[model samples]
Target: MVKEVQKRKINKEEEIHISSSDSSSGDEKELMLKNPLKWWSLQGKRNPTETKRITLPSTIKLIYVTLAFVPRLALYGLVFALGQCCRAVAKLFCSSVGAPHLANKRILYISDYMPPQVHGIALRVSQYTKYLRSNGHEVHVYTCCVESRARTSFDHPTLPFVANPFNSGNQISYTAGIKLAWALGAESWDIVHVFYPNALGLFVLPACRWRGIASYCSHHVAMDDYANRYLQIPGSPLLQRIMFLLYNFLYDACYRWPASYWGDVNASMTQTFVKRHLPLAAKYSHVATIGSGVDTQRFQRRIPTNPDLLWLWCDSQCASEREALCKRIGAPTNAIIWLMVQRLAPEKDIHIALDALASLAQQRKKMNKELDVWLVIAGDGPAREGLEKRAEQLFTNDKNAPGRVTFLGAVPNARLPSLYRAANVFLTCSRSETFGLTVTEALACGACVALPRCPVFDELYGHVLPESWRYDADDKCGGHLALIDAAQAAASIEASAWLEANPIDASWSAAAQDLDRQYDQAVKRGKTKYTSLRSYVQKRLIHLGRASLLLVAFYFVLSYYWRNIYCAAQCRIFLPSLPKPVRALCILTFIIALEWCHC
Candidate 1:
């Protein structure tokens, strides 16, 4: 009775209600195996191996475009463009945005969008915003509300959007650029932080420079995720090339563009980011490992319960895969409780989980044993329908099956902590994860995890958990059999026994503490930089003080000269008030003057 009560308690804590979904694990593996750079080259003929020189035609085109813009507009553009070149100098002069240690520093937090979007990058952005603001930094977000499948109802009130380009196919980015310029001028910001070099970030970059604000770029993902998630399909090679160029351009902008760092929070993701961008990024910038952190307080274990033989799976792509894995493991019905929590996406490879479960049922039938198990699913996704259809077909066909699979879709994040507490084990079947934040959350909740040996699984949890808690899909059938054997052995060894044999509470606490320490260190580092910048900017201000009057006079003279040229041109074009030869010579000389100034 005590064991059952303990099992029930663990179930309540760790039970994850995931939605039904189907995705191909095979496809995911294939995509993972390919070298992203080579694949990138194949898709767009981008020469990652060689330094492609910018052609004179491109430079000429840029020059001509600059000449076409109004002189005042051009001046603003030049200031912004020049700022990119002077970021290191600017940082030497003023505090960069998001650098810790400057009190009351106004930070312009630029990102594509914040959560509750289905995208991992978006969620990370949201978390960063939340933590930064909570820490008392004055932060603001500017992002495009583009029509995407992932956007949810969560809004960062402090970080409000100026506009959303969800419907209009027109160039929405241009409008954003105009708005960004206005924002930069309106506020006194210490630094402008661009999270990614996407459309929005690229657009506002110039505005940051024109304002003489220190800027930063956070390379948050491996460059490959962009190709796989956004640039899908074999065609669109030109777009790929353009993206690569833009990434390179942004890389050149920041004083120091930090890659997601390994051995930090989201260590696996940081490591992956480094691996993907190191070839291109290492050349120009100091690519350091600054990883995203988790709020351990929010995810920590709330109640102590004896660990049940709980199978907690999250990933909308895992339904079919989970079924297949259960069949392989031959877990009896009612004996095992398999929980699947995940998004419904083809990239997630969740169908493999379902398929694995179904296979388990077939094996149970052959043995003439009732598989006493419960499969619970939680979450929602795009592939919900197909996955549901599959679960219906598979389970209905199995007459001897004694177990039932339940779907509990889309629970609140607050509710998830309790679910983690109830479960004994966590399962992740996704082939790739930036860091698998949930996996760590489960670990925090004291749920042992089972996953393919992802970078996170291998690096973060390998030493902490038993060998039975992990498996690799790449391994042969024998290897899988070994995993099954280990899992079965682990099941008999009660959670209490496991805990006694391998103590991890101290390690978990230490890891969490270490994360906090890193956060402190980051803040300290930021402060030092900010102080240096403030001092430099103050020095520059002093130098400018002596020449302020002279510069003011020089500005008026330049403005008047341009005004006269504009009036003369207007008179020539609009009225016959000016002589033809005089108008023509005036225009020619004006162009020459503009060209000389540009030079």
Candidate 2:
């Protein structure tokens, strides 16, 4: 649902050139135009090759561009205008058209937080519910709420937000499921969609299935990939096998439906998690690729030029990578500014970034007799103060370092786009990732991303990094070394040995470029395919809604006529308990219900 909105909002104004144009900038463009020698690029150039190749769909493509692209864009504009006519009118139609399937289908969205949580999954959940409600569907989101914080801009007060377990991470929402399911039992629901297959989904999967309800599990992250480095050690193959078996048992025993795992790229650990235990892929044939939701409304490709801003890296993964980059550039400590937007947990390995920065500061003082750098840390977690003290201790030897490093805890979701825009470059150094949503947002915002070439990272960028910069951890440059240490303690050292035994094709830079080009091609192809399907879907939904209205009206009228007959037999115009005016209102309602049936 989130991805649909994103694809729909791509206006004609955003020129998507198949061939590399001279003026495009940033990583996204760089990836798209990586292969200048490709057929797409060659066709645009003045090359003399006249050899026959696949001909162009010039007439058909033009017709499609004119009929589908142009009209839909114009229609979209009209819809926007209609919305402005009145708040309710706009909300009703946009939401309705956006999610017509919701009218007949009761959707239960089990998530961690509705909104005000900056993570990708949370924002998408909020959007899905809003659109679903707009379509007149009985949409309900069940999650725990923080009492101190108010609802977010996207959150509607009337929307139900059931409170439960409170954890900084969105994955831990087990406490709310029992109550949520109990509340939902009263409603006639067609399907239950569970998010983050690891935690909340695990809890909700079985109960929904037992009732013969259509169930879906959106595997946002594979559990094996997410476990702390300690759990991945090779010596613990027995434990690893045990964990994998347990996970497989829970998923297999519970779900008869095809379980879906959607992620940016298939990480080694995630794939291994499946192959080691769930050997047969045929069991979960419903596995399809559903990319993470992109908020087209919030993030656009507008490169902000703030002269005062030296760097703007989100605190998630790039901290350590940025430190290495700073060292390679030999940047002056003060001239270099770094931002770390991450949970201040010990496992995040933020201290490595900090330690590297501090080393740079000392080197600058010894060589140039002066060094200055500002480290801005965002996000609050259990290790916040501990990280702060460590930061202070590391920089104690410096003269201007007191005010240089600042930790502005927990910036809100609304401010992130601007933060990405303000910064010159973005960095993320996490050893593992399930397609970092922030990384995509940062790239879209036009910052050069400095990221490790992990499976998820490679998948996210479509393998579009410069060859010199790409690191798959298996490369001679110790790219895969970090992962080695992470998997050292696995139940059997064989898992780690197996990982080391087979090296990945570490051609991420070219891969990223190819991925982006393919994505553009996909978007172009998908638009046409999507348009046809969308129209069909819309028709089906509208028909379903009309049919439902008819059934509801028929029920109301039949009940009314029966009541009138009963009243007449009693020798009374209406029931004695009901007032005359109330009886008349009931009659009026019956008439309206009849009208609804006809409409």
Top candidate when judged by lDDT against the true structure = 1
- Give Cα distance to truth, residue 304, candidate 1, Å: 9.0
Q: Identify the runs in model 1 with alpha carbons over 4 angstroms from their true place.
A: 1-105, 116-127, 144-179, 185-191, 203-216, 219-226, 229-268, 290-298, 304-334, 476-599
lDDT (10s digit) by residue, model 1, range 1-599: 11110011224312322211235445433442564322222221122112222323334533553454345354445554554445434443444622553554456666654554445556666666555655666666666552345433332222222222111111112124443555565545666666553434434544544444555556554444433543322346676578566645644342123322111111224545454555445553234444544446555553323247333333332333344444533443225655556765455556666666666666778888876645556676445545666666667556665335555667677766656545445556765565666766666655565677666456556676777666766656523433343334333447536744453342333432343344445344444645577668756864675467568877886676667666766666633677755665676577668869999
Question: What is the TM-score of candidate 1?
Answer: 0.56
Q: Give Cα-based local distance difference scores for all models.
A: 0.49, 0.45
TM-score of 2: 0.47
Q: Which ten residues in a row have the lowest lDDT in candidate 2?
A: 1-10
lDDT of 1 at 160: 25
Stretches off by above 4 angstroms in model 2 are: 1-104, 116-120, 132-138, 146-186, 197-212, 221-282, 301-334, 362-373, 399-404, 467-599
Residue 356 displacement (Å), model 1: 1.8
